[model samples]
Target chain A: MRETLRYVASRLATTFLIVLGAMILLFALSALVPGDPATALLGPAATPEYVQRFIQEMGLDQPWYRRLFSFMGNVFVGNLGTDVLSGQPVTRIIANVLPYTFILTFSSIGLAVAFGVPLGCYAATHRGSLLDHLLAFVSVAFIAIPSFVIAIFLLLIFAIWLDWLPVMGAGEAGNWFDQAQRLILPTIALSVGWIGFIARLVRSSMLETMGENFIRLSRAYGLSNRLITYKYALKNACIPTLAVLGMGVGRLLGGAVLVEIVFSRPGLGRLMFDAISTRNFPVLQGTVLVVVLIFVLTNLLVDLSYAAIDPRIRRQGSR
Target chain B: MNPDLPMITIRNLKLDARTEHGPAHILRGIDLEFGRGRIVGVVGESGSGKSTLVSCLLRLLPSNIERLEGEILFDGIDLLKLSPSDMNDWRGRKIAMVFQDPMTALNPLFTINTHLRDVLKRRFPQISAREARERSLAMLTKVGISDASVRLDAYPHQLSGGMRQRIVIAMALLVEPDLLLADEPTTALDATVEAQIVDLFDQLRQDFSGSIVFISHHLGLVAELCDDLCVMYGGTIVETGPVAEVLARPRHPYTRALLDCEIEDDHGGRLATIPGEVPSATWAMDACIFASRCAHVADICRRGPTVLETVAIGHKAACKRSREVLP
Candidate 1:
């Protein structure tokens, strides 16, 4: 128990440092972009006097180091800066769109695991079958194609041709049924490649696990093939897959950016897209920081779960 | 349940594995029997197919098996004729196995409690979880494990190699199998632990009325623990007899050479080793398999296969010059 606590404490410390580093890096990169925030917020036609006052009020006139220090101070207290274009607090804007992005990312990953693990296990168990070969080919095709291309294809088919779902937007604000309807296309578009990737990963892992001595021993003991595969082999096989799934969250979030744009859904991706075009530095910074935080926390959870799944890891350093 | 009948009878068992370079003949025409309540030891060097014979008995041969022709008669039933599901039913319930490396044999993720419970449940599908746990605890204690209750909750990794092996023995015994195949069960343990395990088997012999086929490369262990001994060379049994008689007066050149290879504690010179490499399995079985390594190799040994000829009652050797080569 003490060992686990120590491990978690060390991991949390590292996560904090990583998030801090991302914050500094995001600030530096945003500052380097060749655009004046003051002029971008006010129209280019605004007078020089008005622009000067806007810059002063926003502390844009301060040196980069001082501005970064103030930004860090505000972020520590949950105060993401105000949006230069809309004058809304960056935190509130981010809060509104975060749920949509979370749903998209989580559901996509859930779908990937739900379908991929079983399919991969079936492929491995029935290794040389025609179905295995077909799944292999289809998975490779899905993995090779970009998510945006898949998103556009899905939009073209589901929205333009089939007319089974909505064409765009996050649906009506109050109706969850409409919101879920809008989610299907974007979720599938973002998840298809990951499903393929996870299936391939789990296939190889399960194949290797099946070859382990314990698995053979299980067979020698007369355990059914189904029981042995799922109970004995799959548990060990999933350890590696779990690690990849944790890292996959970040990649899925990135794909959601394109999927959100193609679907015209109001999410972090859409918000960040609009922010970039309008040179809204605060909103972009806030979105990236939130994404980084979620990534780090997801990895932390994966690490903790490793201990739960494999007792060897759980007992490490205790004896 | 006949007292006079042998537990298992293997007749002309031949197995070949498909390889990139055609078939590798693993077990060539093995004929043997395990008497009820007797412990039979099979000793051989690497690639001698001692381990493969165990897999064949379990009907758990790998997918690459190209040819498996034989009759494995368990009691009066022909195991070879049974369906796969029937074989599964026989396994654990009738025949169980102890593996070479206890470290890898038991699933690392499972607790000892789980491993034992699973085996019991599979053998008796209607068994309750509580009943399984009670049986597991009793079996662990019977195998000489201390604090059996606490050890039940411990995972395989939490125990020593010897302890893990004890648990494996417990699992095999939990089903009260009629025949147990132990393939080099002590090769992975240290000497002290090996002695303990051998002693455990010795103790088990008194109560475990079933038959045991113990496979190992340790001649000393075989001599000490086995009632019957079979010396294998290149996938064929070269010699078989009462362990004392075989060790005392080995009738085959290969058996003589194997007995000679055993190092004495008081020896001062370099250790003795069999001169030639083990014969490749791909070679056609047209002659004596051990001819290359047999110091008394004659022209006739290379001409045709030699079948086991009786030297004494219950004693046989697969060498043409068994009488001439008697030491």
Candidate 2:
């Protein structure tokens, strides 16, 4: 238990450094882009004295290095700084939209796992059967086509033509059931490419597990087909499949940007897109930092999962 | 005669498998009657269909196997005719198999109790998990696992090779199967452990009252462990008899050559190898399976399959030239 905690703590420290680096990058890009924040904030028709005073108040008058340090210092002190447009704290904007991003990422991942594992196991067991060939063909086909194309196609069929689900806005009239209905099309669209990618991993892992001597022994022990496949084969296959799942969390979170734009949901992806379009520096910077932080934390969790999947990882440092 | 029957009656069994290349004949007509309470050691070279034959008895062949004909009669009941669910019940209770490589022959993720209870729970459905654990621990001690009680929670990966095999042996015996198929059980153990496993068979036979089907490429071990011996070649039984009679005077050329190839007790002299490779199943054969390796092969040996003929009261050999080939 002591060792597990130490491992997690050190990993958390490493993740903090990574988030810090991403924030620095976002701030650097925000500053370097064409048009000064001072000119953009104070209209061109305003007096130079008024414009200069507003710039001084905004700390744009300070040297670039001093301004960057001050921003970082304020972030460290838990002050996200005020939004240039709204005069509200940037953290408030993130707090409101965070739940939607979580829902999108979690639901899409749940869908991917529910389909990928069984399909892969079936393909491995059947090998050259029709079901195996069809799964391989379709998964590879979807993987190669790109997520954006899949999103557009899903929208066309399910949202526009058939009208099975809502095309946009998390649905204005949404209780739990309505929200779930709204999520169906976009979550599937976001998950199609991921499911395809995960299926291949699941297939190979299942094949390897089935070949293990114990699975044969299980059959020899008078175990029914169901017992051997699920209890023996699936448990052995979980370690490798879980590794892929951990990394997929980050990729799915990143990929949600495209899906959010397509569906126009009020998730972080949409908020980030809107901030970019309106040139709202505080909102844009805040969203980037939040995404970066979540990405780093998720990756740390992924790294920690290696130990659970394999007892050897825990033994690695002990001896 | 009461016609009450021997324990297992394998009559004209034939199994064929299809691979990516083509259809491969695994078992050609195998006719044998193994009576109750007799240990039969099946001796052969690699790819001689020993494993394939044993796997067929359990109906554990790979899914790609194309055709299986003939009936396996376990106590006068045709095993192949039973539905799959019935077959599941027949397997652990009537027949159980312990494979080679004790190191990996048990599930690594499961505790020994998990594997034992899984089999026990099927027949003894009313037994509680706690009682199942106790029964397994007691059985583990029966197979000479020293801390059998403590090892119940340990996985296969945590145990030594010898311990794992012991656990597997215990599992097979726990169900009190009438026939136990052991396919090279000692091949993966150390020499000391091998000796122990070999010796364990003799001690086990007296107490358990079960017939053991031991499969190996070792002729010497076959002579030591088995009361009856069956020699396999080209996916067919070549020779079979009481071990002393068969080993003392090997009639079939293939059987003699296999005994001559035993190297462990050969002292410092160079070991012998059987001449020529075993023929591939895909190749068309119109002769004795071992004709290529026989030194005294006559012209008629190349004609066709040799029929089995009784040489002694419970002995048989499949060679047209058995008289000429015998030493």
Candidate 3:
């Protein structure tokens, strides 16, 4: 128990450092944006006097370190400052956009795990069979194509050609079915890479675990094939897959940006893209912070889940 | 003695294992029988097909491997003819196995109780979880695990190597199998622990009516413990008899060579060893498989396959000149 607590505490510290590092990188990158910050925010219609007044009012007149410090402080207090372009609080804009991205990321991962694990199990059990070869080919194909290309192809086939699903938006505001229908294409595009990678991972790991002594013992005891495969082999196989999934979260978030842009979904990806073009520094920084935070937290959850999945790990942790 | 009434009989069992290269001859028409409540020791060096023989008995060979011919008669049922599902029912329940490496034999993820419960549940599906737990506790205690109740919740990694082997033995015996195939169960254990485990096996034999086929390379253990002994060389039994008789007067050159290899603590002499690699089963052998290493090799011994023939009362040796071969 103490070991688990210590592990959690250390992980939480690592998470903090990662998020801080990400914020510093985001701030440095934003500062390197070409053109005067005040001019970019105020636009061509603003005179010199108006630009200076806007710069002073928005704390752009302060030193870079001071601005960074205050931005960090504001972030801790849940106040992400205002978007200079629309004069809206960055937090409000993020709050409005997060649900869409959340739905996309979670659903994509859900689909990935749902399909990847079974496909991997099937491929492993049916090694050298026709079905195994087919799954291997399909996984390779999915992995070979980039997410954006998959998104475009899915849009082309399902939306443009068949008119089966919407090409843009997060569907009607209150209608769950409409939202689910709209999410289908983007979700597939986002999840395809994970499915391929995870399936391959699970297949190799399952094969390795099946060769383990415990598996042989289980077979010797005449355990049912289903019990042996799912209970014994799959559990050992899932450890590596879980670790991959944990690391995959950050990649998934990055992948979500392209998927969201392609689908024209009103999510953080779309919001950040607009913020980048408009030089809305606060919105860009805040969106990046949220992504970083999610990535770190997901990793921590993965580490904790390891203890739950394998009691040996739990015992080690307690020790 | 009613020699016709054997608990298990293996007749003309031939296994042709499909290797990456092609089919390799594994077992060359093996015939063995064990009486009820007997401890039979199958002793052989590596690559002699001792493990393969037991795997065939359990029908646990990999899919690629094919059994060319065999009749494994147990309680009037042919194990070779049973469907995979029926075989599953027989495994663990009727015929259990204890493996070599105690460290890796039990699943690391599962607790002792869970491992026991899984085996118990298979046999007694209608038993409640609490009753299963009770049985598991009782079995753990029976296997000589102290603090049995607490040990039930412990993972395999939490226990010492000897403890883990005990747990594995307990699990295999939990269902009270009619036949136990222990494939070098003490090979991975230290000498002290090996002695302890062997003692436990001896004790368990008295309480359980099941027969045990103890496969090992250790001649001392086999000679000390086994009632019946089969000495294998290159996938065929070179000698078989009552353990005491075989240990006293081995009739095959290979068996004599093996017995000579076991050094006594008091003997301050150079250790004996048979020279020559075990012939690959993939290669066609028209003569004695051990002819290359045999000091007694003669022209006829190298010209044709030798068959097991009675050289004494209830003792057999598979050598053409068994009468000439001396211990």
Query: Who wins the lDDT comparison?
Result: 1
Q: Taking the true A–B contacts (Cα pairs closer than 8 Å), what share appears in each candidate?
A: 0.69, 0.63, 0.71
lDDT of 2 by residue, A159-221 (tens): 889988777868654487877888888788877777777777788888898888888877777
* lDDT for each candidate structure: 0.88, 0.81, 0.86
Judging by TM-score, tell me the better candidate of 1 and 3. 1
Residue-pair clashes per prediction, in order, are: 0, 0, 0
Candidates' TM-scores? 0.96, 0.86, 0.93
lDDT of 1 by residue, A185-284 (tens): 8888878888888889889999999988888878878988998989999999989999999988886654477778788887887787788787777888
- What ranking emerges by TM-score with the best candidate at the front? 1, 3, 2
Candidate 2: stretches off by over 4 Å? A1-77, A80-87, A115-167, A171-181, A192-204, A274-285, A299-319, B1-4, B19-22, B263-268, B325-327
Top candidate when judged by DockQ against the true structure? 1
For model 1, the stretches where C-alpha displacement exceeds 4 angstroms are A31-48, A63-65, A317-319, B265-269
Pick by DockQ: 1 or 3, better one:
1
Q: Could you give candidate 1's per-residue lDDT for residues B1-327 as a string of tens digits?
A: 675777788999999999988899999999988788889999999899999988888998889999999888888788889999999998889899999999999888888888888889999999999999999988899898999999999889889999999999998998889899999999999999999999999999898988899999999999999999998888898889899999988898878777778854356755578897987899997888988888888999999998988888899999898877674
Q: Evaluate candidate 1 and give its CAPRI docking class based on DockQ.
A: medium
Higher-scoring candidate on TM-score, 1 or 2 = 1
Q: Stretches of candidate 3 above 4 Å error?
A: A1-3, A28-55, A58-65, A315-319, B1-4, B20-22, B265-267
